[model samples]
Target chain A: MEERKAIVEIKNVNKIFGENHVVHDLDLTIYKGEFLTMLGPSGCGKTTILRMIGGFEEPTGGQILVEGERVEDKEPFERNVNTVFQSYALFPHMNIWNNVAYGLKMKKVKKEEISRQVAEMLQLVRLNGFEKRYPSQLSGGQKQRVAIARALINRPKVLLLDEPLGALDLKLRKEMQLELKNLQKKLGITFVYVTHDQEEALTMSDRIAVMNQGYLDQLDTPERVYEKPATKFVADFIGESNIFEATISHMTGDTASIGLEVGNALCLLEKGVSYSLSEMVYACVRPEKVLFSAGEAEGFNIKGVVKEQIYVGNIIKSNIIIANGQMVILSRLDIDEVPKVGEAVNIYWNPDDVVLMKSRGYQIHHVIENASLGGD
Target chain B: MKRSYRARNKTIPLLTTVSPVAIWLILLVAAPLLYVLFLSFLSTDGYNVVFLFTLDNYKNLFNPTYLEIYANSFLIAFFTTAICILVGYPFAYHMARAGKRKKTVMMVMLMVPFWTNSLIRLNGWKTLLGKTGFVNTFLQNLGIIREPVEILYTRGAVLLGMVYILIPYMILPLFASIDKLDHSFLEASNDLGANKVKTFLHVTLPLTFAGIFSGSIMIFIPSLGYFFVSDIMGGGKSQLIGNLIETQFKAGNNWPFGASLSMMLIFLILIMVTVYKKSGGDMEDLGVM
Candidate 1:
């Protein structure tokens, strides 16, 4: 694919709050007219990155380029980026019309032109005939629409949204997410969205940047990020995955023979560093990719007993205990083919479905082990 | 039947909670106001007040001397309120926006003057502004004037005392209102491309107007009836409505006219309060509630 021209580029961005390092050396590029989302857990600096882009914060050491020009020192208004904050941040004193017209008024636009643009933007947000109502008088969804109208009225080069649907009910949030994505596509403006909801990121973003502990874990399309996570953290964070502790027995060409505690498994080495003989590593496979049966498969299958079975709507979630005693292996079965609890079963997965994660230091082993055990 | 019984039970606690306040209002507030309305129509014959309905007190209030006193009282009150707001607004705004430690310090400083009796503070001002007081002594030492200047026994001194006594009353309420303002609103204004002065004019001032109006009324109403400040500070030369009413009842021995004048002061306060409420500009919009 040809590289598109970057509408906004962040180079080596770092933000430190007193003693806490919030955003580490981060580099990213946002293409023009692309809907990009920064997805992370709370306190992972997603909003901080959005704030830096909106000129609400200054990078401790780095450069932020907007339209190929550095805007590190520019005030929020001086930049060609407008933000719709999580709180909506609507001016309570002004009615919807004035709230939407505020930016134009600041630019000293003609009164007639401002009214025209404000009315058009309000209509775009589907809030026609409610121009005279104050923000306090509006419902959460209406307030959110007004906020969008206010931000879009300026016709900025980039639109920054910091969890704009966070205050709405679940149904409204889902509806607004679709509306916001459609609006971004219709406007053809570069949208930099920040959200903690992985589902939201997957639903709306043309590309999603997964971050963890102030580091960019992976950045790719939603399908690629979900199907092929770059790290154990991303795999664990984005969706459910059944990870197995194993050691690389031998490496032959593009495949590595892995020895699981219960049995042997094969790992196709597609990315990351090479594995050595007897090197400890993690083999990760999605629950949906794991097949369960009452009898052992022809090859590379482990025998286990179904410990628990839960029917969750369309899917049956089953916890199977493999040969090494209490180590539970999670698998999702179709509701029509769910096995009963305490039934003997065999679990198997294709070699290509396994993802290899290089084991970190001994401390991280304890960390990951504790995390898997659900300990704080 | 059970639903009606449950509804009545729910209302019982609410009624019990309001009963004491309702009784207090009827006896203390409503009874005195009704008595004043009845007295306003009665005629005074020497020391005896007859219940015969007459408009004599209202008619006498229209006389030039009484009207002049009323006008002067208004003018003094207006000037005092204006001065109080000018001095109090910045002080209150500073207190509101200040850091926690600084805000606490400022609040203590504002309340310290009130801790001492108002009469004591007024006497302290008297000593400071007297002809042989510290101010005149310091100026004499500097040779700015050959002798002590007559700063006391003037309308200016009366205004000074009134403003000093009432400034905190204005500041406290204004601070309470302005402090509740969301700091994000100011940030939002700046983000929308407004300069600091423009933001203050379009956003800050209008939002804080409710507090300003309430504080102004609080200062103006009491200043209208506070006679001791003027009596001591103005040396009884510049008598206000308060002094006139006091003289009518005590020195002039005219109880009925004094009652009528007191009633007029209450009427003026009512009018001011009504106008304030009618303005309908709320502080909640400014995030100050």
Candidate 2:
């Protein structure tokens, strides 16, 4: 949250590979020393943007400025930027010390200096005494650490990481997430991190750029991006949400009365701009934000029948079908008494909890459904 | 007792399965090698083996006339391998980087020479490189040259023939190793402040050294021992160790000396192979170790 000037600026960059347009009209600015994560699904151009910054990819139609100078025509080695590739990309034939010292050696640094710096880098990555081992001998996490050390020893003004922890198991990935965050903070260098894992972005990034199908969907702080998603895609991607089609029936001052498409019940939109009367819209509310009551509550309320209840360790996840056969999912942990299947229940969400956005056509729901089908 | 019996029973099937290969190797490969080694220790008159134990065959190998032939053989083989590597590396690198369809087409083109026997291929080269061959005729007809030029039956012809047949050997292993190169390493090298040339030296070349070594060995070994190319293309002007040994066995009728020459070549090849193995090459890498 420091008042820092922008260190890297992308001006409407576009990347097209053959007929496949991978990145489209991307504009972004990364401030000094901030860990900015490009978070998206597999084909969302997050990696392409990181590569463009690292000089591995040249933008088709725009300029990238690093440290106030245009770098679109520069080679990766010509720019003051380095990348930690997703697969580690350690040289198999070189020992650990040589791998970390590769950039220094290429710069013709003195042998003793290279050795000292390499040792210091290894220690920084907590990989001391591993200089003699080849890359093949190291485990996945160790290889990742070596790759980080290798890229960091160059001391580039900007560091780009492309899913560097993707190969690690869940537990290791969590540990690495914290380590990378601390490393970035300690070095006070800008890091452009790319990953499809929303949890990782939320954990380490100062600001997260959410991408969808080669377009920037939303760029904001993790909390804001999660709680105040700008689009249906952002809401669906960041966390579990109960999203359904609706229409704005009426507006009173700043509040819009929305009619749910499935249940045909009216609910007040409390947190968003009021839409025109009879405009189609999308209604979204987080699963955890919804409170189930046996009777009425002081907020938007809908009645539904419990279709299934799933016990997922600490929390119970339940699916409820309203009278019109529309499904709404909610997770509850406070209730001691569990609801039985087929039991009629009232779902209550605060007015502020409901997010109303203009509908993005029919395929948006289909994409959300398919994406959630593949578990996080 | 039951566990030992079970282990012993396991060995019975393994042994039964492996015995055929062992027997075939001993009969076909080992027996001839041992016979040649035995013959190398005997003395030879001009007409027949004297059947007497002697070291004269190896002593005769040190003669300057025979030493010149060995040196020439080494020089030619070295040139052949060097040329194969110089030309084959870029071609193989391109093949490795090409799309799947182009790669298959290029590979098939490389193998087309093998469909016709190598001897026939060598003869085809001889015909093309002859004084009145296609090249000279084309040049003469194009008015580039006034008269036919001597193309075949020269040292250059011999080197060209050797390189032509052995180029595929160099290319295949190079393709295999280069294709398996992790592309990320090159990108990583570039990201680490190395340019294209530096990346190739530090990453690409060293990573694919195994292929270069194996391909060099493949070209060098055969170029040394296979003299038919030189015989057909060199026009009796260039005599290699293989031709010398062949002459000793046939025209000179000195089998012991020829056997000694064969033994020395085998010993040299074994040493090269042992060095390759010690330098980190494994049989599983390319079956060259």
Candidate 3:
């Protein structure tokens, strides 16, 4: 990425509703014209952060600077920020034209300019002929487009979207994901989107901000977040991972020789870190990164029985239980033939594939097992 | 054939749900209304009413004396609705949007007057406004006036009585509508660069207009016919259409003329209510929530 300028800056912002600390001391900066997604499970304070930026919520502490102006104490309309609400929030009493034209009308823009802008906005959203129809008359996708149009016509410095396509069906959500990404690129407006859907964040965001338990865990590019998660909760959230609790037996240069339940493993150490001898840690590797060997291969020592293979399109997912009853998940392409269930197989991953991090006191597998029980 | 088959199967449940209200409306409501219509067309002597069809009662409605009463009734009912909107709207808006405890307190405050009989409440008001009442006596004691003020039996007193008794009807519908309004709409409005006042005009007010319209109906229709309020507070000095009908029934001994007046008022109410319903006024929005 090129040198980016900051458009919205949140410094040590905290939000507390009643006795619940929704957002803890958080510091983040959203760049100009980049599509950033705040991805987390429910109750992770992503929406609260978006609300704070849009001025719907005031932070209990800290300051928010949009375009270098202090905005935490301002009303939503006082700042040049608009929000596309989760429910669309289109005015039921107004038709499509009026809904899109609402901001301009409030600004006391000339009536002819309002008319021209409304028409142009409706055309841009591909709802040009729907100006007379109420929100109830439109389909979910159309309403979503209208909501986007309504906010964009205001030319807000930053557009805050709270799960804008959450109400759409699966196919439409996919289409809208691409459409919104393209629209953001075309318009070049900073968009701060919030969602619980990890796939959506990965698909649409230029950078993804993964959060957990009111704490921003990692803010990085989608590829880096997927491949090099900075925290245990982020690794658990973005995708499936096989986390093995291990002890660093020794450090040889930039590699940490880890002792796993199955056997010894080597994980490449990240730079600028010194590991003490016999330090407890976790080595996480994605299921698809593990290679299944047909026969005894060089340096392939660990062995497990083929447990279950789930066919999902071209990719096949298999669960392998080692001799000690420790289960490991492996994802492979259907083109690569694997042993049938109950058949013994050798499995190993390259040192670069393993992610080594200091233990954060909780069992990663426990969170993984209950992760689907989403936010409160 | 499939739709017809389904329709037949649906009839039992539909009839079960709808028949009770239908029967009640037809027997109790429609029957009395038809009798009143028949009575309005009959002739009445100074002593007894005769079941002879005549246009005399209808023609009496065009007389200048009754015309003045009709105009006064409209004027007072209009003012009552206007004042109720000016006062009750803010009260309902604030109460509906208030925090839970404050909302409950305000709701209880609005409903406390309804706990007692309305006539008894009006009589209580008569005390505060009557000669040597609390207000006049207090004023005299303060040396603000040398003599007690005559406040009762005036047009202003009648208007006050109507507003005091009917303001609750205005409040309930507005509260219901404002409460049921989607909270996101207001946030969206504000996010779209409209301030609080502009959002109220552009979104909040339009969305809750159903409540205001229905509340006006509830208040204005009843204020027109609440004879007891005018009788007790205005001392029957400011005669409304209700007072006119009441006198024709009791002292005037002219039942046919009274029936004609009632029929005319019913038509007027019918037109207003029809317009209200046509303009997206849903009773469900009248704060049923």
Candidate 4:
């Protein structure tokens, strides 16, 4: 497929703070009207990428193109982008109307036009009748909305949001996440959002870029990034997964048979070719895909004792200790069919449900098991 | 019965925390202000004390000669405060924004001048600005002037002395205010399309107004009553309200009139403070850390 024309293109950007390289050789293309989120853990340089795109920080190397023009040397005000900071950073001295009108006023817009736009923005954020109220008078969610309104009222080519809903409660954050996604779609504005919350990224982004340790692991549609992660880091960061150590036994077409310590398991290689027979590999499968049995009767199954059972409202998470003793598999069962702790059960999963990747130096099967079993 | 009785009975601590602070306030602030107020209303004639309630001292404060001195003092202090702010703001901002080592060095530099006695500093300035002082010598040596310029015993010298003495007081508070500013707010403003100048005008200036006002008040009120700088640096040729008040009390033997002038200065300060408070300004919101 042809590459999408980028409204904002960041090419080989690098940022070094003293001896620490915060963002290294980063490259990304933000499509027009696409809601893209850079998701990562703390200190992974997600916010730095967003700030660089907004022209807040000058990259140590490479170039940034906004609307097909190089803007590396442009000041933040000179660039046609605005940011909604995590703290909202609303001017406490100004009222809601003045706060929303700040950007337009800076552009020397006509007074009437500024008022009209500010009012329209207030309505957009559902903050009507709050024009006279100071930021201190508003609630946390209202402040966040006002921040969004303030950023959007500028009508920049791209809007950058750095964990804009991080300070709000869970319910409000989820609500604002959806509202922000809808607002972006309705306005048809390019949004480059930064967040450490994977669920937030998955829920709102048209495309999610999974980052780890200042490196882009994968950038793809939310479904693809979740279901078919391009790297082991992406798979582990996005959601809960049960990864097993396996050796590639055979390969035919898209199907590969992997030999595990418990038994021989089959995995579907969706889009990788750097593999050979008898090569050590890691298999990733979602916990929901793992099936538990009342009795032992399966073509390819691993027998394990249920070490712990956690009832998590909609789902029952069970930690099963495999025969290897060191390895543990996590299985998610429906809350209606809960399993008893210390009960022996056979864990099985379909071949297509497994994702195979070339194992790095260390395996994470024991780590996941230890976490599930509440091990230190 | 024992449990209910115990629950119903409670005893306050033997030594409440506020007792010491209350005693200190009474001894230092309240008592002195009360005595000054009492003295302002009392009347005296020559060497004899006439304990009579009279409005003569208050009336004498409105006389043209005394009023001119009052206005001169106000103008001088106001100008000194303005200059202090102009010089101190950038200095404080630089100090606040500097790195740890630079900030420490600048803070020490700012405070070092204050360690010297004000009288000594004023005398030093007087010597520097005198006819045969270092400045005139240097200027004469460079052929910039054929004769020694008379800068001492002038209003400019007095103003300069006041500003130099009061600059550290202004810079310290303003530095505290500027230092506590959220850097992200500036970045956010810049991202929102405000230029450097606009950001400074709209965000930085207004946010630090409380500190500026505080520093101004501190510098202005004290400079109004200061006589040593004007007397020493200005060579006794320039007479400010402080000199007038001092002459009335010590030299002119008019204690009642001096007490009245002091009361009037207090009233002016009160009015200024009330104006500041009525303007809906919050000192805490000035970003004072």
lDDT agreement with native, every candidate: 0.85, 0.87, 0.89, 0.84
- Which 10 consecutive residues of model 2 chain A have the lowest summed lDDT? A263-272
All candidates: interface RMSD: 1.5, 0.7, 0.8, 0.9
Report how closely model 1 matches the true complex, as a DockQ value.
0.57
Q: Chain B TM-score for each model?
A: 0.89, 0.94, 0.89, 0.90
- In model 2, the clashing pairs are none
| Candidate 2 segments exceeding 4 Å error | A1-3, A264-272, A296-301, A323-327, A334-338, A362-376, B1-60, B134-150
Candidate 1 lDDT over A258-354, as tens digits, reads: 8888987777887567566777787889877887777766556678888887677777788888888744555554735667888887787777898
Residues B1-289, candidate 4, lDDT per residue (tens digit)?
9987665553223246667888999999999777767777778878644788888888887888766777788889989999999999999999999999999999889877899898988888877889999999999999999999888888889899999998887897789879978988898889888888999999999888877887887789889988988899778787888888898778888777787888877897888777667777565533332
For residues A20-58, what per-residue lDDT tens digits would candidate 2 score against the true structure?
999999999998888999999999999989988988888
Clashing pairs in 4: B153-B234
Per-residue error (Å), model 4, residue B196: 1.2
How many collisions between residues are there in candidate 2?
A: 0
Model 1 clash tally, residue pairs: 0
Number of clashing residue pairs, candidate 3: 1
Comparison by lDDT, 3 against 4, better one: 3
lDDT of 2 by residue, B198-289 (tens): 99988999988889888888888778787788898887789998888888889989999999999988988888778878998754445632
| C-alpha positional error of residue B7 in candidate 4 after TM-score superposition, expressed in Å | 12
